[model samples]
Target: MKKVNFRNKDMAWDISALILYPPGFNEASQYPTIVSVHPFGSCKEQTSSATYGKALAEAGFVVIAYDASFQGESGGEPRYIEDPSQRVEDISRVIDYAVTLPYVDADRIAGIGICGGGGYIFSAALTEKRLKAVVGITPVNLGRLFREGFSQYNPVAALEAMAAQRTIEARGGEMQVNELLPATPQVATENGLTERDVFEATDYYKTPRGQQPGGATRMLFSHAQKTLSWDAFAYAETLMTQPVMAVVGQKIGAFGGYRDGHEIYGRSIASKDRQLVELEEWSHYDLYDKAQPVSAAMEQIVPFFNKHLS
Candidate 1:
């Protein structure tokens, strides 16, 4: 593993990343590459690295896992804001950087994203023709989640409140933020977050299972404006012509990745090679770092990319 950095398109900030090369990698020859994306509120050091990034590299691909702007080791101000548009663009930027490498096979580059990164990777592949093959490991469509409340959320009402807060902040008021996960599982139980997804979220994100600095479960409240309106899979059926795969755990609810995985596979009508895989016993977060689930996921991912990325 090697740490690297590159300026985004605008050169406004540097995106921090960890690049892993397959064994016997050579600079003299090109290799198929993957831009492995971390989940929402996650960084390169987390699952993107611990699991998929490493796993894919071991499977004979050059994988780069990066931190989104304003999150993790990446540069930007008002940190931890989950900007949907920015996240989508970050993948493109990573690809832009990838193409510059002498050892990267420009036409064979692909992307695989976990959790929200899964959704963002799909969004990226919609327009990024350079991404020959794509994978979404339990994706969460951010805009859809915000617009259609995961848990009795009122989109209009929430939008109204977020608009009000943005106005206040623009007028010199204090910045407000939203917490993605409760501080602890016990706290979650006290607050009545009893759903399977919520419990697993608290366990995976709040505890050592997947926690990392800068990948904290928080974001600027005002980011809701764009998040609520953005649609990760909009026009996917018409525009997403790339080979696509949606790997989801059957034990998903509230988290919504299962629904999203099924939706993308069904809706991307133009993707003649699209696939949907449902692992029966694994929950949403189980695929993030668990041995059994991650290993199971790799079985499908390695062969798919191997066949498609040629």
Candidate 2:
């Protein structure tokens, strides 16, 4: 296990990451590498990302997991400021750094993105041609989700409010906005949230289940406006040219991107190698190493990379 901190020229942030290869990794053994992008608010040490990276490392591939700009150990001003454009660039930069390592096989590089990272990697796949394969584990397509949320209110009003909020922040006012993720979950009701979305999210954040050092309980409010319209699905054609694997858990929540991406991707003749693996009785957070789903997903994930990487 080797930790490397590199500066991302595109986003102008000092990106922190770890590159884990098998114990005896050396110049003699050239191995495939997987660049993993974490969920929106998570860092490299978060359980799912760390476990997934280590799993790949143990299986003979070097795994690179890094914090996106403005999150985790990565550097950025006004912490938790979300930028879809910069995030995509950061993914590409990670790949750029990975390919330079002596132990890495540049041609066999792949990417795995979890949760919000699902969509981020999709965006990266479009322009980063060096990536031979991509995996989205319970991905959240920010574009569609944001569109759905924005539909409830007038888009004009929402944009106006965002602009006003930015104005305040620009004037050095304290950044005040709701960053939602409950530390403790309450019982679910007839409200829009299902048991899994509300309770499961709480369980991951509240308990020691998947906590990372210095992890935030609340996020930047302005980030909500930033993530709403960041749609990566429109670039399916570019992404589909490379092999893609999507994993979703049936029990947790229905991730629309996998279904939606499949719908768009299946219609193409060129997108032949794309595959979707639906894990039964699994929740979104369950993919984050919550026993039942993690083991099964890992079974599929390891083999998928092994088969494609070589």
Question: What TM-score goes with each of the models?
Answer: 0.96, 0.89
- Model 2 accuracy (lDDT, Cα): 0.72
In model 2, the Cα lDDT at residue 169 comes to: 84
Clashing pairs in 2: 252-283
lDDT of 1 at 152: 45
Give the C-alpha lDDT of model 1: 0.89
lDDT of each: 0.89, 0.72
Candidate with top lDDT is 1
- Model 1 spans with C-alpha error above 4 angstroms: none
Over 175-279, each residue of candidate 1 has an lDDT whose tens digit, in order, gives 997787889899999999878888888898888877788677788887557888889999998999999999999996787999999999999999959989899
lDDT of 2 at 204: 72
Alpha-carbon deviation at 57 in model 2, angstroms: 1.2
Best by TM-score: 1
